[model samples]
Target chain A: MLDEIDRQLLQSYQRDFPLVHDPFGEIGRCLGIEEDEVITRYQRLKDDGYISRIGPLLNHTKVGVSTLAAISVPAAMIDSTAGMINSYEEVNHNYLREHHYNFWFVVAAKDNERVDAVIQEIERKSGTDALVLPMVKSFYIDLGFKLWQSTQAD
Target chain B: MVTDQDIIRIMQAGLPLCPEPYASIAASLELDEAELLRRIDAMLRQGTIRRIGLVPNHYRIGYRYNAMTVWALDEDRIDAVGELFGAQASVSHCYKRPSYPPGWPYNLFAMVHGRGLDEINDKIAALKKLIGDDCRQSDVLFSEKILKKTGIRLKNRSSEHA
Candidate 1:
């Protein structure tokens, strides 16, 4: 369960986290709390798995390339197939879905060729044809959640 | 102008979590703090860096039901429909992707999250009604398990390009 301060921190700092020196201190100043207390609370949030990390969300397309790839694997083969795909470090997000194309994953690489290569590799290893869907255009991205609303409701 | 690769190399792993994070990063890259901030500001302005902040774990915060809902719409209607879905607060990622006919027919993809499946289904129904005849068919691909999730890491750029 998150307190009001934690909810406020999550909501306010989703973006534009202080870039200056003593960022925690800066945040403390804003929240009317001590720097040490802020750090402690942040650490607790992270430890409790509420916060993944305090860092930059890199724009992958600006720096590299990425594609959403999905493969239809038989129920019996799902576990082994997912394990094989997950072995590749480039495959960052792998999820089991409800469609015929049961396994889906996103591969982020340095270039288009590498992205294709990963798709091919996964197809060969999984023994299933994979559909590689690269984003033609992004209408919207970076969907950060509103934690405050959930906290308030609770 | 600083090369994007240089900026990526410096900031790929993320800014250090400490006092003077930018100062340390600038020092490592042999750049003045002001110059580093200037480049970052420029990137933000140019849409290179979408955002810089703490990414919350939605699952931990009660948004456990998530789905990547894909819709098959006329190519002409994609932009308009995409814009509509994109504008919604529930839709996180909306994009136009190539649709392979007969097997995979979804061209417009939108990801939505909720506290439960009922909520997700409600959002999907709302989107479906909004799309009406523009959408021929649609499917919700609920995320059953997260195998791996991590920020991008630019592998040895020189080697890759070379």
Candidate 2:
């Protein structure tokens, strides 16, 4: 469903964006399109849920602390527990996965105290002990992939 | 003077979608565009901001399957394994964390993306080929459903941010 330009924009713009007064203009220049078209396409992409946002992916350790906490919630309480955890603004990414620790979510905040507090609160309130696995070291992998690599390879 | 924290607070929400996005951000903070751009550049230099660009949701972009592939590897071999798998094109996020044995025993998390289970299986087989013997056990945890999802929310200085 994606056109060539849409595919290019999605593939190429994952990182190293131009920092300028008119960044969209700069992007337009690179892709041989007008600034307005770039903006409109990006906006449509966001609306269509193809792209989330255009911004900096923060280095969590440098700015704020975060933890990948998982809780083994029984099926009966899955909905209630997810709702409660989602209520917290700090819990941005929550997923229902297939495992004993079925309820997995990320808690990110300005400090470790806030991170711990949220986890503790979840454990106490839900009566489900959480496995708090704070990131020790992040091994770097390049973000984004060649969405059309197979076709392009030929 | 606009501080780095202030910039962080503003940018946590996301870059604006307009012709002159940075200028608009600077105007909101009542700071000049040059100064704001300087701080952003500084953050990029210092490795605080990983990247500044458009991020696509994997599923929407035809990557319908993503596995938070976790491995319980021997402590001595974890570092080697982490570096090896981290370089793979299929793996997006690879990290080393403490493994709680008995219930959870996954210390290395390699978040892999694939078009479907076939592609994922290929990548997994490749990974297994490379990380032989070092890995004690592994499990693939797929996201059955998203209970809640927000792109990224950066907390302000004990205040609020999107």
Candidate 3:
């Protein structure tokens, strides 16, 4: 159960966090709280797993290349196939989904060639044909969750 | 122009959680605090960095039911349908991808998160009503497990392609 302050912090700081010498101090000013309190709350949120991290969400398209890849693996071979795919540093997001092409992962690399190379390597090692689905157009992309609303039904 | 490598190295590790976070990072990179800020500002303007802030773990925050819903729509209506799905508050990511005929026929993908499958299904029903007959078929692929999740890391300059 989160208090109003925790909810406020989670909601307000999801994007456009102050870029200042003392950002927490700035946040403290905004919320009419002390700087130390802001830091403590942030630490608590992270410790409690409510928040993953405080950082920049880099645009891989500008910094590197990436693709969403999927492959169909038998139930008996799911574990081993996932292991093989996860071995690549380029593979950032790996998930098991309820579909024929169950194993899905996102691979990011410095360039397209490298992205394809990593995909090929994964396919070779896993012995599963992988479908590479790069985003043709992104209609929307925002990861922020409304914690205030999320906790309301409870 | 400052290279992407410099920015990636600083950002991949994550922004420091301190009173003077950017200043601390600038000192290590031997960059003036103002210049570092300016570079980051430029990146923001250019869409290199999507956002700089706290990212919550939705699962931990009670959004346990996560599903990647894919829709097969009439090719001509993709942009319109994409806009409709993308505008929903529950939809986090919406994109257009190529559809492999016969086996894979979903072109528009949207990820919806909620407290339970019922909540997500409600959203899907709303989507179905909005899309009408334009949506040929759709399926929800619920995530069973997360094997890995990490920020992208760049290779050394020597190995980087020109």
Q: List-wise, what DockQ does each model earn? A: 0.64, 0.75, 0.75
Winner by lDDT between candidate 3 and candidate 1? 3
TM-score of each predicted structure versus truth? 0.88, 0.92, 0.92
Name the weakest run of 10 consecutive residues (lDDT summed) in model 3 chain A: A145-154
* Tens-digit lDDT track of model 1 for B1-162: 556567766776655655577888888878888888888787877777777777789999899888999999988999999999998878888999999997888999999999988988998899888878998988889988887777676665665645
DockQ of 1: 0.64
Task: Output the better candidate (2/3) by DockQ.
Answer: 2
Q: List the residue pairs that clash in candidate 2.
A: none
Best DockQ goes to which candidate? 2
Q: Write one digit per residue (lDDT tens) for candidate 2, span B1-162.
A: 777777877886778898889999999999999989998999999988878887788788878787889999988888999999889887888999998886788899998788888998888888888988898999999878888877555655665644
i-RMSD of all predictions: 2.0, 1.7, 1.4
Query: Which residue runs of candidate 2 sit more than 4 Å off their true CA positions?
Result: A150-154, B156-162
Candidate numbers, best TM-score first, in rank order:
3, 2, 1
Best by lDDT: 2
Clash list (residue pairs), candidate 3: none
lDDT of 3 by residue, A1-154 (tens): 7787888788888888888778899999988899999988998888899888887788878877899999988899988887888888789899999999899899998779989999998888778788889999988846465555554311
**Relative to the unseen true structure, what is the C-alpha lDDT of residue A122 in candidate 2, on a scale of 0 to 100?**
96
CA lDDT of each prediction against the hidden true structure: 0.82, 0.85, 0.83
